[model samples]
Target: MSSERAAVSALFLLNGLLVGGWSPRIPALMERLGIAESRAGLLVLCLGLGSITVMPLFGAMTARAGSRSAVWLAAWLTAPSLLWISLAPGFWSVAAAVFLFGGTMGGMDVAMNANAVAVERSRARAIMSSCHGFWSLGGVIGAGLGGIVLELAGELGQGLAVTAVFAAGLVWAGPRLLRDPPAPDQPRAPLRLPRSPLPFLLGIVALASMIPEGAILDWAAVYLQKEMGAPLSVAGWGFAGCAATMAVLRFAGDGLRNRFGAVRTMRISALTAMSGLAVAGFAPSAGVAIAGFALAGIGIANLMPIALSAAGNLPGMAAGVGLSVVTMMGYSGILLAPAAIGWLAESFSLGAIYLGLALLLLVPLAMSRLAAAADFGSDTAP
Candidate 1:
């Protein structure tokens, strides 16, 4: 179990590392292609489309093959796909590569979360938050280190380094992942949409939580670099700062949820995140904006994990099915935000978009009760 947990954690980290490594390069990618923010956003949208397209199929695959196989398959595909983005010379080529990256990433996201649910169920405890914490930790390393490497090695070098590290991690974690036998009753279809309001509502909560997160991941550096006059080399730290605090709080989130109950924890988290966004949106300087992002991280850290836990435990639904539905819905925020925010930012300001996103938190805050389902196995659930 311990080895399995470690392996899952490593998978989460590697997944995050890939994203983190990519986040810092968005500005450079835009520069290389000589594209406007709107065009870059459309390119980013391709990523979300790819992910959304593949998620349901991956969900079914996870159900039919067991999560370990799904994880390995996605991981193998995901690692090398980064090179496609790094090397693509034109807009169409980059879009195609990003779509492939998003597809693989979406597959891995579903598989790994399913694996985390299995691990949590076996222990009859909450480790989902901690697993995500390792992801944030990886983001910190990826963004922080990636920025340095980008300055020294350029885009291709950074891509190679990230891919190499991910491959090495895969080699180490592959055999250690927990392998569950495929259930005879598992769904074999390529896609299965949610039939219940429960998954949709949970997905809404997850979506609300993830939009800002995706914004931060995809745009925070650009926000810092273009708006605040931060150097390109250091702009990545905006997200690095956010992921740092997110990692810390997420490591502690399971305990908070176990003790305070998921509902109360969610309420507080929503408020904190809202406040953080407001701060960032209104901040006069980059440093303050970074601090605000960190604060937002504290609030945003455990939201999707808790929602995912609830989805996994939904009555009458298979874990993979429920996870896939909610995962696809939640990730839609990532899909939607880049293009929307790009258009909106082109019209208004990025700060305005951040401010607007802060208000969107009310939806999740009002729906906090839904998170109570996350406490399915907890003795301290309220």
Candidate 2:
């Protein structure tokens, strides 16, 4: 519980809050603009693009510049991106801003993970899950506030502006908040590429894990509205149900991880996700599908945090690079190829998409165990 760890954890929470706060407003924004569902999806893709662009580059940026500068810059950058989304004049413009926004988010993630690992190493205990739990708290606040703010004027743009104001506050405080420099007790380790077959296998697993999340975030409403024929007002219940489950599970994740260990927690979580996906995908009624998503959310809530903690533990590279690579791969699923999932839904069925993602989780479940075997000394995975 060093000040450095506290600062980074706060930053992590801020990022989650920002996402939850802004993301739910997307449909509102689209409606305000009078755009089609498919087009709105494309615009939302821009945030992914921004994130994807930064993921691959985080390692080098952290290595050359150090955490204080890179991370603070990233935090400041993120707040403004919400404004861009708020003011987007056209689909492409929003897409570009989102791409840049995603990049900042990616960089922030890498630096935060790296810093978290360093703190864990310093403290010599398990804390990553607790830190992540804070992120869950942030999401709860973000989603709640985002919902409230957007409801005020029932205006998406104003919500964006308010979010931007929050971003500005983060920017102002960032310098004072960031660790002055990331100085590991161990001087710079040589950059060993995570060629471990484990990383490659794990990357795919990360992608698969996110597919369900992407679906929850992007497609659930549509599925309820178009497929289940639920009323427009009720459509959002699909995401709300899923997110609520995720938020609750994530808040409790630290307790679970400490009690069961990352490996056991992950294994159980995977099973939950698989079962939830199947139930939701094939449900006969909208209520049933909502229940299924809740199950899926509970299952998935802890998986990503566990996997990310594993990446931080990999011995070869600095935690920053390891996190960057894995994070980049995971976000790639959302940023680059998810639109294709939309295409797939168009041709196939939404049920097909969930099933495909569920099947994909098995790969990660296997890798999660492998990663567990390789994990060093329950030494509090960063």
Candidate 3:
């Protein structure tokens, strides 16, 4: 069980490393392809579309093949997809590469989460949040070092470096992943969407929790630089602080959930996140704003993990199917909402956007009772 948990955590970390490593390279990729920002946004939309389109298919695949096979296949495919991005020659080629990247990454995400659920069930306790914490930690390392690598090694070199790391990591961790048996009675369908209200409501909660996180990832630095008059170096700290705090809290969250119960924990988390957004929106200085972002991170850290655990445990639903639905909905906020938020920021102010997201947190807070589904077996309180 411990080995399985560690392996799953490594998978989550590798997934996050790819995403974080890609973040700092976007500008350079755009320049290389001579694509404008508007077109780049459209290209990014392709990535999101690819992920959303394939999620259900991956879910079905996991159900039929077992998550272990799915995880290995997706992880192997991801390295080449990333390499393709570095080799892309034009806007269209880059868009295609990005789409493939998203699809493979999204597939692995579903497979890994499904496996995580299996691991948690085996232990009769909670490990989901700690797995996610490793992911957060990976993102911080990848993003923090990506710029340096890009400058020193160039795009291709950086791509090769990440690919090498993925390969090495897979060699170590892939064999250790929990072998989830394929559902004996699962239909051989190509896709299966969630048909119940419970999964739908849980998806909504995940979506609400993710939007503010997306906003912070995409705009926190700009807000700090423009609105709070921070230097460029310091401006970067907004997301950095948030990611760091999120990583820490995520590591701590499983214990918190075990102690407080999922429903109460989620309610408190929603309120804390709301408060963090309010603080960031109204903060008068960059330092204060970074602190607010960190606070928001603390609140946002465990939300998706808890929601996903609930989704995976839904009665009469296959773990892969339930997870795919919730992840598809939750990821839309991260992958698809940047453009809409940009438009809103242009129309109003980024501060207003933050506060608006703060208000949006109310939806998750109100619906937090749904998270009680995550508390199963030993997770139940006395």
All candidates' TM-scores? 0.97, 0.85, 0.91
Per-model CA lDDT versus the true structure: 0.89, 0.67, 0.81
Put down candidate 2 lDDT per residue, 161-246, tens digits, no spaces. Answer: 55665665465446544453443532345545566665556667677777677777667766776688875455555666666778
Cα error, candidate 3, residue 316 (Å): 1.4
User: What is the C-alpha lDDT profile of model 3 across 5-61, one tens digit per residue?
Assistant: 999999998987787676566556656777544565566577777777777777888
Predicted candidate 1 versus true structure: per-residue lDDT over 1-382, tens digit per residue: 4999999999999998998998888888888899878988987898899999888888898888888999899999999977889898888999999999999999999999999887887778888999999999999999988888998999899999999999999999999998865545775554557668999999999999999998988889889998999987788998899899999999999999999999999999999999999999998999999999999999999888889989888777778888998999999896667767776767787887899999999988999999988988443221
For candidate 3, the per-residue lDDT at 164 reads 88
Runs in model 3 deviating more than 4 A are 27-38, 187-190, 221-236, 283-286, 377-382
Q: Could you tell me how far off, in angstroms, the CA of residue 103 lies in candidate 3 after the best superposition?
A: 1.0
TM-score of 2: 0.85
Q: Candidate 2: misplaced stretches above 4 Å?
A: 32-37, 144-148, 155-165, 168-196, 229-234, 284-286, 373-377, 380-382
Measured over all alpha carbons after superposition, the RMSD of each candidate to the real structure, in angstroms, is 1.8, 3.5, 2.7
Worst 10 residues of 1 by lDDT: 373-382
Which candidate number maximizes lDDT? 1
Worst 10 residues of 3 by lDDT: 373-382
Task: Estimate the lDDT of model 3.
Answer: 0.81
